[model samples]
Target: MKFEIKRDRLLDGLSDVMKAVSSKTAIPILTGVKMDVSAEGVSLTGSDSDITIQTFIPAEEDGKQILQVSEGGSIVLQARVFSEIIRKLPTNEVEIEINGNFQTHIRSGKSEFHLIGLDPLDYPHLPDVQEDELFTIPADLLKTIIRETVFAVSSSETRPVLTGVHWAVKDGELVCVATDSHRLARRKTKLESVQDEEHNAVVPGRSLNELNKILDDSADPVEVVMTSQQVLFRSKNILFFSRLLEGNYPDTSRLIPSEYKTQVTVNGRALLQAIDRASLLAREERNNVVRFSANGSDEVEVSSNSPEVGKVEEQLLAEAIEGEELKISFSAKFMMDALKAIDGQDVVIQFTGAMRPFILRSALDDSILQLILPVRTY
Candidate 1:
C-alpha cells in the first residue's frame, strides 16, 4: 500500500495495536502488523489469536488532512521493526510504498528503509461476530469498572473460567465479578439504557487489561457487540475483538454472605498504610499475612509477627467499630488490592466471622464490594 500519513497519528495507532502482537506466537505471520490502504483511509491490525485490535486513520479529520492516498494496496510488516522505524522517522509526514512482490519502502526526511513484507492474503481474518447483541457504556466508567475487579481474576489456568471476569447484565445494570478463590471482587453500575434481555459472558482478564490500556478515559461511549464465541468493543476509531473463554463462570452469589457479625469503618488510607507496613515483616516469614483486632470501642490494632524477623504493631482509630469483637488474619497483598479498588475516604469492613470471608465496601459508594477469605494462622 502507498500512502503519505501524519507521523504522530500513525505512531499513536501503532502504539495501541502493538499490544496485540506477540513475538512468540505460533503463527509466524501473526507477529506482523497488517496495513491496508484504500480510498477511505488506512487501517492497521494486530493480533495474537486471543485478542485483535484494529485502528483506522481517516483521510481527513476535523478539517485536517491526516492521510493522502497515492496508491491503494495492503502489506504486512514486522510489527516490532516497523513500529520502531516509524517512531524514529525524522519528519511529521511519513511516506510508505509497497512493491508488487511485498517489498515495503518507508521514507521521511533524509532517512529511508526497505523491508521485506509478508503476504497480506495470509493474514487470519478477524472474528465475524454479528452486531446483534450490543450495548453502550461510557469508556471512562468501563475502564473504572475493569480496574476495580479485573485484578482478582485467577492467574492460574487450571480453572479456565476463573481466569476471566464474569460480566452479567440485568435490568439496565451491569455487574463484573472476578475471583481467584482466595479473594473476590465485584463492581456494579447502571447503564443509561435498558436491554430487553439479560446477558452473561466470561471475558479473559488478560484481554480486558489490554483493552483498558487503549481505552480513552472520556465521556464518549463505547459500543460492545457480542456473539456466541467472540465479543467486540468499538469506539470512534478503534475496533477491539476478544475470544471468550469456553466454560461457564461459577455461581458466586452464594459466596457473598448475606449477614455480618462485625463491621469496622476506618480511614482507607490509614488502613492501607498499616497493612503496607505490616506486610514488610510478614513478607520476611513468607506469609504476607496481617492481623486486625479490635482494641477499643472504636480502635483497631494492626500487627504482624515473623519468627526470623521482628514484629510490627500499630494502633489506628476506627471511624466506627461495632458488633462482636473482631480479629481476622488475611493476606496483606489481597487486602491492599481491595483497598486500592475501593473509592472513598473511608471503607467499612464487614466480617461474618474470623474463619469466614470478610467484605470491604465504600462508605460513599454502595455499588462496589471486595471480599477476602481469612487465613488460618492456627
Candidate 2:
C-alpha cells in the first residue's frame, strides 16, 4: 500500500479510530490499526472485539487534497507508534508506503521511520449486520442522552450486565437507563418513528461515552442500526459499532416508585453547592454520606459529620415544599451526579420514605429522571 496524505487529516482520523484499540488486547493484531487505501479514499479501522471504530478520508475534498493513493492495498500498524508519529510529524504532508510483505515506511520532511507491519488479512473483520431495523436521531440528542445516563453504569466487573446502559424502545419513546445499584440515571426522548416496536438492548457505557466524544454537535441525524447482538452508529464519514452485552438487563421499571410521601423543589445549583461543601468533611467517612433535613416549610439543611474530621452544615431555600418534613442521608457523589444531569434551574426531589429510593428530576422536564438509594445513617 502506498499513500500520500496530509499530516493533520491523517491524525484526525487516527485519533477517532484509536479509541477502539486497546493496548492490552489479547490478539496482537487488535492492538494495531488497519489502514486501507483505495482509488477513492483512505480508510482506518480499529477494534478490540467489543467495540469497533472506523473513519474514512476522501482523496480530495473541496479544493484540498487530503490523500492520494498510488497503490490499492491494506496493512496493519502498531496503534501506539503510528498515532504518536502522525501527531508529532514536523511537516504538513506525509508519505506512507508498504511492500507486498507488509513492511511499512513512513516519511515526513526530513524525519523518516520504518515499522514492521502485519498483514491486514489476519485482522478480524467487522460484523456485516444485515438487519433492516434502524432509526435516526439527532446527533445532539444522542450525545445528551448518553451523557446524562452513562455515568451511572457500574464500574465493577462482578456484574457484567450492569456495566452497560440499558436501552429500551417502546411505543414512540426511547429510554436509556444506567445504575450502579447505589444510584440510577434515566433519560427518555420521544422518537419520530412512532410504532409498536419493542426492542431492548444493553450497550456498554464505556463504548457509548467514546461514541459521544467522537460525535459532533450537528443538526444531521445519526443513523442507528440495531441487531440482536450488535449496534451500529453511522454519521458523516465515521462508523461506530459495539457488541451488545449478553444476558437480560434487570427490569428496572419496578425500581422507580409510583408515589412519594415528601416532595421538595429546590434550586439545583444551590443544593449542589451545599452538598459539595458538606462532602468536604464527609469524604473521610466510608460512605461519604450527606444528610438532608427539611427544617421548615421553605428551607432545608444539608449537613455531614465525620467522627475524626469534624462536620459541616449548610442551608438551601426550597422553591416549594409539600407533604411532611423529611430527613434522609445519601452518598454525596450520587447527589452531585443527579444535580449535574438535571437541566432545569430548579429540581424536584420526591421521597417515598427515607429507606426507599427517591427521585430527583427537573420540575419542568419529565423526560429525565435520577434516582438515588438512600444510605443507612443510623
Candidate 3:
C-alpha cells in the first residue's frame, strides 16, 4: 500500500480512531492501527473487540484534494509509534509505502522510519449489522445529552450492565438513563425513527465518552444503526461501533417518586458554588456529605461539618420555597454533578423526605432529571 496524505488530515483521523486501540490487549494486532489505501481514499481503523472506530480521508472534499493514493492495499502498524511519527513529522504532507513482506516505510522531509507492519487480513472483521433500525439526531444535541447523563453510569465492573447508559425509545422520544445506585441522571429528546417500535439498549459509558471526544459540535446529523448485540454511530466519514452490554438495565421508573414533600427553586450557580465551598470541608468526612436546610420560603443554608476540618455554612436566597420545610444531607460531589448538568438559571429540588432520594431539575424543562440519595446525618 502506498499513499501521500496531508499530515494534519492523517493526524486527525488517527486521533479519532486511536481511542479504540488498547495497549493491554492480549492480541498483539489489536494494539495497532490498520491502514487501507484505495482509489477512493484512505481509511484508518482501530479496535479492541468491544469498540471499533474507523475514519476516512477522502481524495477530495468540497473540490479539494486531501489524499493521493498511488496503490491499493492494506497494512497494520504499531499504533503508538505510528501515531507519534505522523504527529511529529516536520512537513504538511506525509508519504507511506508498504512492501509485499509488510515492511512499512514512512517519510516526511529528511526524517524517515521503517516499521514492521502486519497483514491487514489478520485484523478481526468488525460486525456488519444490517441497517434494519436507524435514527438520526444533531451531533451537538447528542453530545449534550451524553454529557448530561453518561457521567452517572456506574464505574464498578461487578455488575457490568450498570456500567453502561440505558437508551430507550417511546412515543418518538429517546431517553438516556444512567445511575450508579447513589445517583441517577436522565435526559430525553425527540428522535427520528422509522417505525412505531420500542427499542432498548445499554451502551457502555466509556464508549460514549470516547465518541463524544471525537465528534464535533456541529449542526450536522449523526446516523445511528442498531442490532440486538451492537450499535453503530456514523458521522460524516467516521464510523463508531460498540458492542451492547448483555443484561437488562434496572427498571428505574419506580425509583423516581411521583410526589414530593417540598420543592424549592434556587439559582443553579449559587447552589453549585455553595456546594463547592462546602465540599472543601466535607472532603475530610466519610462521604463528603453536605447538608441543606430551608428556612421558611426565604433562604436555604448549605453547610458541612467535619470532625477534623471544622465546618462551613453558606446561605443562598431561594426564589420560591414551599411545602414542608426540610433538612437533608447528601454527597456534595453528587450534588455538584447534578447542578452542572442542569441547563437553566433556576433549579428545582424536590425532597421526598430526609432519607429518600431527592430530584433536581431545570425549572423550564422537564425532559432532564437528576436524583441523589440523601445520607442520614444525626
Candidate 4:
C-alpha cells in the first residue's frame, strides 16, 4: 500500500481515532491503527474491543486534492509512534509505502522512518449494526445532554449499571438520566422527526465523554443507529461505535418527587458563588456538607463549619419563598454541580422535606431537572 496525503488532514483523523486505541490490550493488533488506502480516500480505524472509531479523508474535496493513492491495500502501524512522527514532520505532506514483508516506510520533507507493520487481515472486524432503527439529533444538543448528565454517573464498579447514562426515547421525545445514588441529573428534548417506535439504551459514561470531545458544537445533524448490543454515531467524516451495557438500567422515574413542601427562588449565579465560598470551609470536613436554611423570609442563610478549620456564613436575598420553613444540609460538591448544569439565571429549588431529596430546576426551562439527597447534620 502506498499513499501521499496532506499532513494536517492525516493528523486530524489520527487524533480522533486514537481515543479508541489502548496500549494495554490483549490483542497486540488493537494497539495499532489500521489504515486502508483506496481509490476513493484513506480510512483510519482504531479499537480497544469496547469502542471503535473510524475517520476518512477524501481524495478530493472542493476541487482540492487531499490524498494521492498509488496502490490500494491495507496495513497497521503502531498508533502512538506514527502519530508522534506525523505531528513532528517538517512538511505539510507525508508519503507512506509498504513492502511485501510488511515493512512500512514513511517520508516527509528531509526526514524518514521505517516501522514494522501488522497484517490488516488479523484485526477484528467491526460489529455489523443494522441501520434500520435510526434517529437524528443536532450535534450541539447532543453535547448538551452529555454535559448535563454524564457527570452524575457513578464512578464505583459495585453497581456496573450506574456507571452509564440511561437513554430512552418514546414518541419522539428523548430523555437522558444519570445518577450515582446520591445525586441525579435528567435532561429531555424533542427529536427533529416524530417516530412511533420506543428505544432504550444505557451508554457508558466514558464513551459519551470521548464522543463529546470529538463532536463539534454545531446545528448539523448527527445520525444515530442502535442495535440491541451496539450503538453507532455518524457525523460528517467520522463513525463512532460503543457497546451498550448488558444489564437493565434501574427505573429512575419514581425517584423524582411529584410535590414539594418548601420552594425558594434565587439567582443561580449568586447561589453558586455563595456555595463556592461556603465550600472552602466545608471541604475540611469528611462529607463536605453545607447548611442551608430558609424561613419564609426574603433572605436565606448558607453556612458551613469545620472544627479544625473555620466557619463561613452568607445571607442571600431570595426572590420568593413559599410553603414551610426548611433547614437542609447537603454535599457542597453536589449542589455546585447541579447549579452549574442549570441553564437560566433564576433557579427554583423545591424541597419535599429536610431529609428527602430536593429538586433544582431553571425557572424558564422545565425540560432539565437536578436532584440531590440531603445529608444528616445534627
Model 4 lDDT at residue 26? 96
List, residue by residue over 1-378, the lDDT tens digit for candidate 3: 788999999999999999999999988999999988898999899999999999999988999888888888999999999999999999998999988789989999999999999989999987798987888888999899999999899999999999999999878889999999999999989876546678899999999999999899998889988789999999999999999999989999899989999999999988999999999999554788999998685999999888777999998999999899889999989899999999546899999899999999999898899999999888
State every prediction's TM-score relative to the real structure. Answer: 0.98, 0.97, 0.98, 0.98
Q: What does the lDDT read for residue 186 in candidate 4? A: 98
Native RMSD of candidate 3 (Å): 1.0
Residue 29 shift from truth in candidate 3, angstroms:
0.7
Best candidate, lDDT? 4
lDDT over C-alpha atoms for residue 202 of model 2: 96
Considering lDDT, where higher is better, how would the candidates rank from best to worst? Answer: 4, 1, 3, 2
Evaluate model 1: give its TM-score.
Answer: 0.98
Higher-TM-score candidate of 2 and 4: 4
Worst 10 residues of 1 by lDDT: 279-288
Give per-residue CA lDDT, model 4, range 197-267, as digits (tens).
99999999999999999999999889988889999999999999999988989888899999999999999
TM-score of 4: 0.98
Off by over 4 Å in 2: 194-196
Q: Which stretches of candidate 4 lie over 4 Å from their true place?
A: none
Off by over 4 Å in 1: none
